[model samples]
Target chain A: MRELQLSLNQTQKVRLQRALEKLESLSSKANSNASVTVADSIPVNYEDGLLKGHGTSEFNGEVVATVCGIVERVNKLVYVRALRARYKPEVGDIIVGRVIEVAPKRWRVEINYSHDAVLMLSSMNLPDGIQRRRTALDELNMRSIFEENDVICAEVRGFQHDGLHLQARSQKYGKLGRGQLLTVPPYLVKRRKQHFHHLENYGIDLIIGCNGFIWVGEHVQVTDDMVVDQVNKSEQDDAKPDENSISPEDQGKNYTRQETRENICRAANAIRVLSTLGFNITVEVITETVDLSTSINVAIHEMLGSEFYVLVAEKESVRRSMTKKK
Target chain B: MEYVSPEGLRLDGRRPMEMRQIRAEIGVVAKAAGSALFEMGNTKVIAAVYGPREVQNRSQQLNDSALVRCEYTMANFSTGDRMRKPKGDRRSTEISLVIRQTMEACIMTHLMPRSQIDIFVQVLQADGGTRSACINAASLALADAGIPMRDLVTSCSAGYLNSTPLLDLNYIEDSAGGADVTLGILPKLDKVTLLQMDAKLSVETFENVMQLAIEGCKAVATYIREVLLENTKQLEYRRGI
Candidate 1:
């Protein structure tokens, strides 16, 4: 009963249990009892010149685990990969976070890590797309760019003396809006080559943050129009009489259709079910779950029902077994 | 009152050195990084651990180690007689301090520098030996949170009454005005991190009682290890390759 949060009938319960058992059998063959609890000794040959890594310590000339996790060995180095813990950031990883503080020249973001990540004003590309230095006026207007409590997407720049640093250089990395943010265990979100996915069919954007903060939002065409807008504004300042026409994109900014909202909900619920089942979350699996619900004609809200959960479980079992066969 | 019968059985039908049944469940709190509910007979405690994250108070952040904070509370309905208790009472403050110090001894604080870890344990049922139950629950929560520790710390209580040494004292025995010893130990390292006794006892008798408590702790440690290992495997296998 790993996830007993849902209420299921006897038949559904049996089916789900059987599916989970199959998953257990499938995974156990690959990593048979590689787990170690606190203080359990990890067997390592002394002739290899062992180098201990995180989550390990030496006790009485024996390497013992300091956490409950799977023992991972690479060459002569031994380490434990902990699950169900806070995000441990690495450089060049894409992450989603919420701004917690607006400091003098930086915004502190809560990225599900041990420390709040700092996004300095200078590290980000300003709206004008100019390469000028950050002036005092820009410092005063930092709130206009990203104020407190704004959900942001950024990259792990590096570690600073005080805390982790984040950068938002690309237009794809910025304020995320009109969507849902789902928090799962960070381990479930494996780092990938492309974290941003725009499902062309659903007209929705799915961002899989490395910190396990998943954003499901309506797809907005990636644009750097703010720089163009700034240039046009300065030009139009002197010729204000001829600035009557507005771009079609500016007029359609907040007009998300109701159907698109439903699509967003459907996709978000799909993610919810998969995360609850502890399945590996990739774009492919998420889209497949959504498609299953749609094909079965399950309502968006009913996707969380007991029957749908059982169906998802059975489907996952079939999917994994097929992959294993290949 | 004869606490131990002629048959060498306590009031609850357990032998002098026998402990009460223990049960543990992990991930009881959805929002916490780690959570566990542990029960020792009628004494039930729930523990939640948060962070190894940024310290809430900037001034209190440690430069080279994580700051460990603990708060212990007892619900009004947990006891037989419901009584309104003030927050931060003297007894609870003392117990919190004891639990914090015992936990800090085993946690590898230096690994998470400039962060703070918060441990909150509440008594759901207060039969007796609440201190020992709280310690065991906190240890499980810490392990579930994936926080590094030197060793798992397990605690148990032993008492001397009716000219016999008893393990895991009940409320009646605990309030009997006898010598009650609460011991916490790192079972793997064979090191004692905490020991507290209220009443007086002879040297030989104290040694015997302490030994009984340590044995109880080791038993509890074995149970906890089994629970953690099972939970870890479940998580691993569920998130399959």
Candidate 2:
């Protein structure tokens, strides 16, 4: 019932409930009592010299949880992993965020964190691919690079005194366009080795941000030739006044084919259904969902219908069971 | 009027020490970080918590702790009279301050510095003891948001009518011109965060009424803990390993 606000018929409701119950049963029984609410004492062997970590505090000489979460213990360290909380950034996390403000020499991005992350202009590679000091001219043209409200993919640079800082030095980490942005609870997104995925068959790109901002868009290859061409084009413009404001390459990239657009929507809808069903989202599951929808001939929009939600829930239960068997 | 029958039953057919039926639902507001709807008999309240995020006002940002803000409102149709009331009236503002102070005391604000947390509670049905209902709803919402807190806070109201101390006073009993006491406490820590009393009562009678309210709070706390634990288990199982 939490965020599963679907209008399902009686039969569909019964099916969904059954699927969810199966999922519950499939979960490991070892940690059934591991879940603790606020102020609940986390039983531990105090004689072992345990160190209290986040989401825990001392109360009456006993370790009490300060948040509602699962108790996690690692050797001498004891902590609680909170669910449904805001994104807690760690170094080297790939995140997608929207530019909230174009501050002086930096762009404040709303990355679903406690504070807007700061993406300094110096941290990112300029459009021209030059490795030189940032001049005043670069500051004036900051909007051209990342305008306000632009969705960008960057890495979490270590936090400074000001706040959390981000860097986008790689070509793959930059502004994203012609796509849909979906926001889910940060806890649902597990950090993995690969966050970026390019589905060759669908010709679409999927970015699973650690901060829970997902990007589903037309695939754009990150090649050095495009950077060289941009540098040459800028030189040409300086020598002779440009006849057309928009370049042919820019136009081609901006115009997404109908098939690719549909693929983007399909992938985005798949994520929406999975997140609502509270399933752990991964590339394998997303692709499987997409394949399931297409094989069944469900329209892109219908992927969000009540019937599909039930199907996905059932499919996930079956898939999880199969994995357990392995 | 005979508020309590000689047989010890109140008008609503409940004993003087018995509380109304309490119900709670989490994640009622889909958009909020944390939300809950709490009901105490006929009094219903919805609470939504947003934040532990960037402080909206730069000047108000705290260097060593998070700023907690609260707003309390009553729907025009919440009461029986259906009177249109202006926003931020004197009574509402006072109640807001009281709720904010009570919540701030339990929330571990120092853990989230330079951020602001906003708690919004609205009364859908104002039967009686709206203040206590709002406090309880806000506490649930905060816990749902995963905000760090020293302990879960629960509140309840008690009033003296016909020399009998009643728990969880309803609208009729609340307006009976008798002494009404609203108590908020961190049930796990066993510390009082808020206590408000209107009208006058003798020392002995005040103690009796306060004792009844404390017992009511402990009962509410047990129910809240059960709700939270159930919700946590649901979320955990759904997001299986």
Candidate 3:
């Protein structure tokens, strides 16, 4: 079995075991027999005209699971939901990716999918927020917009003949900077109404990519001021020669503050702890973890320590049990 | 050398039909999409599966099906001789081919078009039946990685030694210049995906040995199913609703 590789003291080990057992008991009452392994047949009523979905197949007049996972039934359709698999993209889901190649008119993005997604130059709103056909000059300057290895956030636009396509047409979706990117198993992240969260208290922007790539960074306001600023900077350059000298200093001034950086690390560490414990990562759970660490006065790095892991497990168990009672 | 004693016990004190202790663990490699450590007696193998992701080589990408690749390696200390074998030796390459073909027969490659799945298995200890152990490990890793397969492929080796068909030989009996039959089977499908034998045996005796190997494979399949079920349960319960 996959186990957490941790060195825990005697009491901590017992506590972790107790918490896990509690979690098991709480969930087992709901759907204890829903999980199935490969080649195991799912008991379905053939008379009802069942439809087999992904991770399931017909074998010798029986519906058998093709993967190791839980069997889900939605009315007449039955399918197996695989855990710990790669990100399976769905249209309209928000995702974070890394630019692997700046192609002629499209940027090849790695979104932890079977194939790299194509983000066309025409699909995304230009940095200037203008709506026009991408010109040859824009194709040549694609690297300046999103060069190789630059992290990007976009929405799944659907599949095309070439491959999966993504678009960033809104101000909320675009280049992500000043952040730490984390990857957990894609199954941990469910499709929720909101994937982008701006923690006003910590001044951190958390973009929970459906593809399992998470970005925690200093918040950048979503506004058209950057475009106006660019336009004014050009005019300033033509009007005054000395403004050019201060431009480089302006680039240096974009650095994040020390306090905000610490908060980002703290939030990132909380996520790491949650993913390691195999907990479902939601905005509420993440903030609760961060709050737990702060309330206990644990150092940012200590959030990854074994004690914190045990504590989180206990807290999650308590949270689930309480929710179950209602 | 008499591998089977008059009392019908083999050198390892196992009966002619008795197989070695088989143990399997999943997710040993944290970074791998799917990984497993499988052991049969003194033989131990670790396998990791990556991808069903982007195909690395553009020329090798298949339009209608996913490309499957495998690599087999043995640690320097895996063998008793402790010789440092060169990478991709002839033996390892042949075993890698055998494992790849065996796994390809069961995986539903057609479902994952234009992608590639890579299986890497390394022998940590070699007693006998390392090939079979590697195949079993690869199957577990593939299933653990949540790759779609028609059925779990399990393999076992049986040997004809000293006028007896022994199930799961060890290193000493393996080098006895006897007939060793390595069999891979899809238990649920009741199909044999791989069958290889070395050193000639009578046709009638070969059937008995192959049957014994099939039995061993079924035993392995049962154990693997239990392990996989337990793993699935743990993951589901831990990630509560």
DockQ for all candidate structures vs. native? 0.76, 0.78, 0.87
Full-model lDDT for every candidate: 0.93, 0.93, 0.94
How many clashes show up per model? Answer: 0, 0, 0
Runs in model 2 lying further than 4 Å from the true structure: A1-3, A225-227, A230-250
Q: Which pairs clash in model 1?
A: none
Give the DockQ-based CAPRI class for model 2: medium
Least accurate 10 contiguous residues by lDDT in model 3 chain A: A244-253
Q: TM-scores of all models?
A: 0.96, 0.97, 0.97
Which scores higher on lDDT, 1 or 3?
A: 3
**What lDDT would candidate 3 get against the real structure?**
0.94
lDDT of 1 by residue, A137-209 (tens): 9999999999899999999999988679999998898899999999988889899999999999899999999
TM-score of chain A of each: 0.93, 0.94, 0.95
Model 1 residue A167 distance off true place after TM-score fit, in angstroms? 0.5
